[model samples]
Target: MTRMLERAPNLAILYPRALVKRGGGHELPDTRLGLRDVAVERERLTEYHRVCGFGPSDTLPGTYPQVLAFPLAIALMSERAFPFPLPGIVHIGNTITQRRPIAATERLTFEVRTGNLRPHRRGRQFDVVTEARVGDEPVWDSTATYLRRGAGTGAAAPEPGEVLPTTAVWRVPGNVGRRYARASGDRNPIHLHPLTAKLFGFPRAIAHGMWMKARCLAAIEGRLPEAWTAEVRFAKPLLLPSTVDFGVRGRDFSVASGGRPHLTGRAVPAPGNATPHPG
Candidate 1:
């Protein structure tokens, strides 16, 4: 928690350096990242909402703040002292909470810090904690959990989630990952190209878990409050150019293919939350 880095990070530059960062990525230290004066461009925001299947509106999408804070999270995770490499790390789950509605007109401040490494059956895991604020008011926060397979104590893996009946079928093209990467700045190779994915043991390019979460939120967007929390667990990889079953029961939802679960989660109203933001 000592060294604090502040900059308007360029994804194009940072992404390449992250791939070959120093320190073997075995040290778990708390590092702070700050990006002040963050503003939302309406045009870009609209495209993001469209790509994620959410209807465009003046109010920010529930999951968009996390998308805003992701580059800062990447800066922390790619540090030499981090416990795992950026490449091949699996995004197992994500939990996001917003205390109040976030309007499109407000300027934002983003802070990201990474710590809390612990053992998992598959290997090791850690959380990248992020928060977004408008001056002193907290708008959103998230705990994105990732697992580094084969880096832990070999304990029993966690049990699976409930499997619901297929509600809808989706044809996810191979380029969807690349599309999302362009919008979200998550140019992780495993999700973009089949050849790069094979290097990491995936048979084909895979979908971004966050994209799945966003699409899930879009499916039930009108129902969610401006301020709410969503907890999503990524059960398996959604292969690109694939068809998947999407099931949503009230606030609980799931995406699966061939009986294999890909993403599962629930959305709940935040404390004192009532009305949705108006356009």
Candidate 2:
């Protein structure tokens, strides 16, 4: 019975002109690739590709966008000029639609824009839409909602809607962290190369964000009613060699570790859906 906020009529205006004026528009300089570099032949995409747990010959994994997308969102939202408290937000859920396959060596300019904004019954919780583009072409898009902790604004929590009970649970082992890094091309030293992690303030290599995402999807597909829409908040990053417990209860779902909740979400069966496959 947690209190939540009612949907706002002007929720879309949260990213006000003032907030947009505070900083440059959503532009990721580092992500943009010069046209000349876009077609260059390189072996890095094929060689030394263990970071994502994928061989150079393998295709980019589904959750690969997190390496750049979420970071870009954080950077834009954290501008001191912006009104919302970026750190206080929780990533409720993420949905990504890929228009085409992304080559590892392809260089391109990337941009993001905040789109739809819908308020949830939970106080201060709002759904935000983010769209990513490469050189004027929409490449991928995700809609994520977040719960603003400690922001007591608007209405009381709504009664739990249709309940979809848990079906199964999965235990994510520490080693899967390493394997995920190898499959994805993200060799961020934080997820591999222990020495690099130490320099970056981590005790050891941590799990790739995408791996955790994949794990979540796997859990949901196994338990909840099929076709349920999921909205999740990333909250804090989960480190390596950690044990994660994923479970479902009624229509509510939760992922936890060390007795602490890492993600909280809900799901329902997809209309005209079939059985889910192992991810």
Candidate 3:
């Protein structure tokens, strides 16, 4: 079953629901959530571009649709029928596929669902799938993998590979998370002030993974094709107010701080203009 809506549900309203709804089931909710005719406000879009270091353009950034679709993703995860608690779940990886450049003026329809639950070395993992469309044609889609830590499979952690050569160094400000939160509406406590992050076991505030992805895309914006895919696996937490090294090799890119990688990702042109999944 799918529940369709004409407007986006408020994040302010959904966050509380996520806090109160406890999850422990083995099966995921069978229903999918959809929102139609979602408008794109230019002012908000520009702010997002500025915060993520993207230069001005008529088309939307590849990661922008995820921000537009995020509220519904939260709504789906906040359901009592969901199988994992929202509070402690971790976003481990994400892959975004863009069929073509979406104009900032285009009205979008979004749909979200979850599946592919399986065991992980640290605990369990699952996918939160979201897609965006202009009318009936799919324009963009993403799969965000999340982990819920608990009993492990006892597998050895994967070893780190050779660090890529640095091309540039960036000084990330302490308030980057707040800026991105305002732009993207993802105000996870760990990404906020140091005091709030301490409650989550972090010594200081951390960067948002999606923001890291968007920044990486901005770094290689000139090289991206009209239609493409970008994927990233997040590793260490990037502490706030740090200077980090950025590197790129062909279509691949990485970010590191204190000689440790915080993220690794790549972007490549989509093959043959194939239609993207509608989710």
Displacement of the residue 38 alpha carbon in candidate 3, Å = 1.0
Number of the candidate with higher lDDT, 1 or 3: 3
What are the lDDT figures for the candidates, one per model? 0.81, 0.45, 0.86
- Candidate 1: count of backbone clashes, pairs at least 3 residues apart or interchain: 1
- Which stretches of model 1 miss by more than 4 angstroms? 1-6, 22-26, 154-157, 272-279
Query: Model 2, range 1-279, lDDT digits (tens) per residue?
Result: 111122211212333322344433333122211111122124433322343334343333334544444434454454453345543444545655544545444443434444333344443554444443444655444565556555455555433222233344444455655565444334445666567667767777766555655555544444543233444445345666666666666545555665565655554443322322121
The RMSD of every model to the true structure, in order and in angstroms, is: 2.3, 11.7, 3.0
Model 1, 90-155: lDDT tens per residue? 889899998887778777788888777788987888888888877776778899988877756866
Name the candidate, 1 or 2, with the larger TM-score value: 1
What does the lDDT come to for candidate 3?
0.86
For each of the candidates, give the backbone clash count. Answer: 1, 37, 0
Model 3 residue pairs with clashes = none
After superposition, the stretches of candidate 3 with alpha carbons farther than 4 Å from their true spots are 155-162, 272-279
